[model samples]
Target: MARGKTQMRRIENATSRQVTFFKRRNGLLKKAFELSVLCDAEVAVLIFSTRGKLYEFSSKSIKETIERYKRHKKDIQAKNPPVEQNKQHLQQEMASLMENIEHLESSKRKLSGEDLGSCTTEELLELEQQLERSISSIRTRKIQVFRQHVEQLKEKGTALAVENAMLRNKLSLQQERGSNKEKATVPSADISEVSDVETDLFIGPPETSRKRAL
Candidate 1:
């Protein structure tokens, strides 16, 4: 036969309640003593009777044990702060970050020439000076970039000039060689390609030509 399971609830009869409390309280005290003695553990227990009686047990002096417990609890709490404290800290940090963001946004708006209606004369002057400084820096950078470009162009121009000179020298040499070949082949036909005529015909300015024509 299965034994009936005892329900774990208050015994309604006053005499039964007192008896149960006395029995359980002594059992708990005995367990605490055994745990401390057998396991080398610091144990404490507290029980209250219905008639306002206190039953307490501790491996050492109860005051000292409680103080030690308080110290250990403090150390544990210090190592791992409560969730509420961490939450509050995060909230404060977020608030500070939001404030900084707002300040930066306001500054950006001011710099962009927006939200100027609330600015004082002194603030506006400061902004103007800041803008002037910024513009000066931009102009300096532009000049620097322009000078670099100019230097690059000058280098390219020099390179082109040197190339042109080399080409001219080569062309001159080729022309001399061609002329010598032509002279050896046909001395009578010593014809050469020239850009200008070397005659005594002085072709002056257009006005002089017109005068001479007149």
Candidate 2:
């Protein structure tokens, strides 16, 4: 004879509930082991009971599997090099160039300050030419730096504008969602749950009932 099916309600007796939990847990673990063995597959299972007990199973060393997954991820990232590595390399080169440029400018300032007024007219003219050339070079570099700064500011401004638009859209969406949820949770206008509450507070009751209650 077939046993009767259990009802879909919480078990009233503690003993029966415990027995059921034990039987089911063992059956589930057995099935998982059988699946791993039959399919020759790696599997990990973690179970937590209502009593705060933990159960775990793994077809392979869990740590080894996780490490293998990380290795695969690293390999995939290594395959794509142009955009990331090239950008980083270019940035590093630019920074080094800027540093060397600052050092050279400092040295030039020191050289300009050294006294050469007692020198010959020919030497003076040569020095003047050198000074002009240095000034021209400095002016060119300043222009380049200014242009780069302007371009960077423009890029930053554009990014900020995009971010602000996204935030505004997100805020608008959140407000709309909140309004919809409020409407759903509220009772219908026809139902009027608060109408009686308002009346009880403001309206005078029958005189006889009031006197009797008092």
Model 2 C-alpha lDDT versus the unseen true structure: 0.82
Residues 1-214, model 2: lDDT tens digits: 9999879898889999989888988888888889999999777777888799998777887677678879978898888665778899999999999999997775565457654555678866776788899899999999999999999999999999999999999999999999999998777764775564422333466885567555
For model 1, the superposed segments whose C-alpha errors exceed 4 Å read 1-19, 147-214
- List the candidates' TM-scores in order: 0.62, 0.37
TM accuracy, model 1: 0.62
Q: Tens-digit lDDT track for model 1 on 1-214?
A: 9989868987899998888778878898999999999999998887777778888999988898889989999999999999999999999999999999999999899999999999999999999999999999999999999999999999999999999999999999999999999779774444554424444455778778667656
- State the lDDT at 57 in candidate 2: 78
CA shift at 205, candidate 1, in angstroms? 80
Backbone clash pairs in model 1 (N, Cα, C under 3 Å; residues 3+ apart or in different chains), count? 0
In order, the Cα lDDT scores of the candidates are 0.90, 0.82
The model with the greatest TM-score is 1
